[model samples]
Target: MIAVVQRVYEASVKVDGEIIGSIGNGLLVFLCVENRDTDDKVTYMSEKILNLRIFEDNNGKMSKSLQDINGDMLIISQFTLAGDCSKGRRPDFTEAAKPDAAKETYNKFIEDVSSKINGNTAIGIFGADMKVSLINDGPVTMIIKR
Candidate 1:
């Protein structure tokens, strides 16, 4: 599993012109599930994201974790993150997990993180066309893979 996590002032997801999920003062996570990912990987990734100290502390240092700040999370399914672009012009998605398995992993990750966090956990539809909007706080982003 891979996650592109961004600290955001606010974020939202829209499907077919309807807002399905949204959040404020949180992390916007773009997640991808790989073929080899296991439940252990899901738990590891969730813990890593929740404890990442990207948010600022009272000293204005980047020392606060999302859990420390009680921030929200917007998780989106993004299999494209697994695309292998080292070959030809067209990227290869062979590393991405198959749809059925990927969705199950995605949901489990969401549920695990949701159960551990204090704030909201918003999600995008597993296979739908989604539009995500956000005001990136500090434009801070990190990629975690497990």
Candidate 2:
């Protein structure tokens, strides 16, 4: 499992000129499921992203977790995260999970986070052509993998 998490003031996803999911004062997550990913990996990655202390506190220190600030979450499936371009001119996606398996894990991840955050969680369609927009707060981004 891999996730590119970005702190954002606002974010949204659009499909076919229609807005699908959006959020405010939250984290925008681009996630990818690898062939070797397990249920345990999903659980761990969700927990880590949720509790990451990247948000700032009153003293202007990055000490607040998303849970502490009650922030929203926008999760999107991006299989290209598993793409490897180290060898050839073309990128290889051999490590990416098959569509069926990837969707299952993606749903599990969304379910896990939604269960924790309730109405604050938003998601892009699993296999749709999604257009995502966001105002990246602090330009703070993290690449999390397990």
Candidate 3:
């Protein structure tokens, strides 16, 4: 599993002109499941994301976790994270999980994340054309893989 985490002042996902999920003062997570990903992978990733100390502290140092700040979370499924572009002009997604497996893993990941946070979890449709908008806070972004 891989995730691109971005701190955002606000974020939203729209499908067919209808807003499906949105959040404020939180993290926007673009998650991808690989062919070998399992519940254990999701568990590890969720724990890391929830406890990651990317937020700022009193002295303006990045020392606070999302839980510390009571922030929100917006998760979106992005199979392209597994794209391999090493040798060819076109990227290959052979490492990405198949649709069925991806959907199941995606749903489980969301459930795991939601269980950690209070009540601020929002998610995009697993296989939908989504338009995501966000005002990135501090321009803080990090990528994690496991």
Q: Pick the lDDT winner.
A: 1
- Model 3 residue 133 lDDT score: 99
Candidate 2: give its CA RMSD in angstroms: 0.9
> Which candidate has the highest TM-score of all?
1
Residue-wise lDDT of candidate 2 within 107-143, one digit each (tens)? 9999999988733999999989999999999999999
Writing each residue's lDDT as its tens digit, candidate 1 over 1-146 gives 88999999999999999999999999999999999999999999999999999999889999989999999999999999999999999999999999999999999999999999988899999999999999999889898988
lDDT of each: 0.95, 0.95, 0.94
Which pairs clash inside model 3? none
* Deviation of model 3 at 108, angstroms: 0.6
Roughly what TM-score does model 1 have, to 2 decimal places? Answer: 0.99
Cα RMSD, each candidate: 0.5, 0.9, 0.7
How do all models score by TM-score? 0.99, 0.98, 0.98
> Model 1: runs farther than 4 Å from truth?
none
Task: Indicate whether candidate 1 or candidate 2 has the larger lDDT.
Answer: 1
